[model samples]
Target: MTEIRVRDLRTADPEDTAAYAAVRRAAVPALLATAASVAYSCEHAHPDARYRALVAEADGEVVGTAQVGIAQDSPEPGQGFLNIYVHPRRCGLGAGSLLARTAEEYLAHEGATALYSWVLDTPRNRAFAARRGYRASRTAHFLRLDLARGGLPPLADPPPGVELRSAADFRDDPRPLFALDAETAADEPGDVTAEFTDYAHWLTETWRHPLLDHELTTVAVVDGEPAAFTLAHTDGASRYASGMTGTARAHRGRGLAKLAKNASLHRARAAGFAEAFTGNDSENGPMVAINQWFGYETYDTEVRHVRTIA
Candidate 1:
């Protein structure tokens, strides 16, 4: 008899991790996820977060997956998150429901008070979350640009004392870039209110990420100091994604983030990437405007939902 069962995503088994990535990609094609990145995330996640990936297996095949964890860097305590997805073809097989209940039980037992998850903007997906007591919070848009023919803006020379650099340039000393990322990320809009204060954590979870394309990531150097950057994540294929685009608080009005993104996109195109993808919070007018200026079209949207678990 075939039955659905939820279990840990075994990082040691390459097949298991690959299946997890497969289901997630099938459910959300806009996302750039790889087996390496999935395993790396589970192996290097911050201990405080209690992070674990769960997969729903039916008939010995993975049909659904979930990312369960607490907000390790959030200022508030007992904040947890669960992101679940089932293979588009395998929906209605009860995998999604089983994953949700199992994930909630884990988070509730871990002292989670506020639980959050992302549900795709579809009637069925919304109804699933609502049945579990989650209310909509915010919406985020995933935008895509045709790198080969989006009419990408031509590269411009940086102003005097401002130069564009690649993330690879900072390999010898990434503390400067880390400092810049921490400053910019803290100011970004979010419900968790997380702080990126731990340098070691950043290096582990961000810098060493499998998808991070150092050569494609552009950094804006102001008088030899890192101030803005556009991080790039590539699937080692044709797909390229903007991991983050941010500028330090001191360099907000200088348009350094836009400058870095332009450089990154140009380089990615040159390297033969066919498509570029990025996501922005619906409320982030400035970022949305920048993405729009890049000729990126809203391809998909996901709504965040939150429920009081305690």
Candidate 2:
């Protein structure tokens, strides 16, 4: 067997992104990833984020990839992440271990005191993480809805003084959407708390992302103010993903998030998307219930794993 070696991503080569995206899509089909998103992340990563993309090669073939970065925006210091994906057919060839070790060494040198990763909730995957000194933590569920066959709840009329709009409506200026996103993200259930304080960064990293579908993203407006929204992302084909669905603190009880998501899903299906995917932390009952209402079923679950860098 050829020795597997890991190296930093070569973003200048188009095949680099394609290979990395393929490995991720095959290892975890529930998440939506594209070559453009992969390249953008590598090229536009925040300076403080200290991002690095690593690929594992064996016998001249790319067999795995890992995204390593410091959580610079986290309230806590010295936090980092390493998400490694090995091609399904290439596991056990030392690709995963090599990539993980490379990621850990790099992040530690970047001042990271702890490392976090998401591993599929399966015996083999869990064992793999355990062997690398990681312990299990919180769990999240990946839900999927077959848009072509799922019985979607019909879209309902917004209440008086409320209106529905697409994200495209904010193309002129997305500061308002950015503000709402920051607020909601701060309150989201997660092990790593993120702070979205830079508008320019958000515009470049998220608003202009290739996978983001402005026409399919739905927003709920109350009296002309943005209240809740569901951001949609697509593969520009038959797959759709709910990038995020959130309601402003002031609009929590109004079910605006649900309304926005429903509208977005409707638009996606009508536009020919056949599959819809979304994920939620197991502790988030409200979002889980809402997804269930939309006929989304739990397709897979992943457990968060943490390791301390001593």
Q: Give the TM-score of candidate 2.
A: 0.98
Q: Write the per-residue lDDT of candidate 2 for residues 184-238, one digit (tens) a residue.
A: 9999998899899889999988899889999999889988889999999998879
Clashing pairs in 1: none
Q: Which regions in candidate 1 have their CA more than 4 angstroms from the true location? A: none
Provide the lDDT at 149 for model 1. 75
Q: Report the lDDT of model 2 for residue 132.
A: 93
Summarize candidate 1's per-residue lDDT along 224-267 as a digit string, tens digits: 89989999999999999999999988888888888999999999
Q: What is the lDDT of candidate 2?
A: 0.91
TM-score of predicted structure 1:
0.98
Residue 229, candidate 1: C-alpha displacement in angstroms? 0.4
